[model samples]
Target: MRQQIVEAREKAAKDGIRVQRARTPAPDVAAPVGEVTEATEPFQDNGTLRTISARYDLTGQRELLWIANEGKKVGDARCTQKFQFSNNTTPRERPTMLLCWRTSQDKSVVVLAVTPEGRPDTRDAVAKLDTRWSAMG
Candidate 1:
């Protein structure tokens, strides 16, 4: 995942796209949880814009909060709860779906698939990752 992040940044730079990463501070809780390992990156492949991210919480107690906090960033109304995947979209005119899921007790992943206005949907890529992770556990 770290390698992927580095590659994504390099690709983004090569394509003349500036990647701005937003770091969300963990919520204020009574007790401090263990350290979290996280990585996120956005890049373009075959004309499709994709963002992949993962978070691993040692305590396995903040997965839900992390997901909800991410949803809030996009927009509460656009987010919908599913069995495992929490699906949402950006608030732009042509929204890009953000597919996220908790893959294990302490790990969660999020993916975004974007294409040109008239291009075919690339969301399947995101779904594939979800399926693969779910199967591993």
Candidate 2:
């Protein structure tokens, strides 16, 4: 656990990502499980990373959906997960922390699912990130 945190911090530094901790409490709608580490950086895609912290229960389902929406908003690519949320269903929360960026050269969106301890799950992070790349098309 400690190793993961250290690694993530090191990667962030190497990538030149400056982690930005929130100064104030986020709204209930934006953050229900309590906000975790929120960080963003300018990268290759010309898209700024927007990571919304979630909790342990989060499966990143909604975050994927949100990313799709963002792609649509930015006039780039749209997310492929097309299931619409019903009014009665409360979407699952996202990971406590999300690390997002683009390939330094290709500008592909990279999404990493972070662990509760605030460390990114490096093993599967890039794979999960690849799933969202389809939306880039």
Candidate 3:
């Protein structure tokens, strides 16, 4: 099943679609949860303009970027959102990260990463992270 998803992503990339595999921060790492310091900024995602909601230096490695439905604070309940995949034969729960332009030929957003738990579905804290890399916040 994972292989099928990989193949599909590869096909999309070949067609000019951007797919991002979100990286999970190590369990032992910790960082400050910062406030939103900039207004929504416009960025080029594969030549399309997309707006970024906020950015923070969560891990000090890179600025965490996000797009929220409305104004929100750092580490607030609304900071994270749920995304479901089309495949659901096993009804597994996985945390995923996605970003993209609202309008595009494929209407496909970049899938940054997906992590599945061995046990019951547990929400991944990484999905709520501010790990997006951007030049301007």
Alpha-carbon lDDT, every model: 0.41, 0.40, 0.32
Residue-level lDDT of model 3, residues 22-107, one tens digit each, is 43444676744544332332222322122233233343112223333331233322322333222222222233333221112211
Q: Higher-TM-score candidate among 1 and 3?
A: 1
Q: Best candidate, TM-score-wise?
A: 1
- Select the stronger candidate by lDDT from 2 and 3: 2
TM-score of model 2 vs. true structure: 0.25
Q: Rank the candidates by TM-score, best first.
A: 1, 2, 3
Per-residue accuracy of model 1 over 25-82 as CA lDDT, tens digit each: 4465343444444444343434343333344432223333323333332311122122
- Candidate 2 lDDT over 27-114, as tens digits, reads 3434235333344544233333334333332323334333322322212322222222343343343434444433322234535343
Candidate numbers sorted by lDDT from highest down = 1, 2, 3
Of models 2 and 3, which has the larger TM-score?
2
Top model number, lDDT: 1
Q: Estimate the overall C-alpha local distance difference test score of candidate 1.
A: 0.41
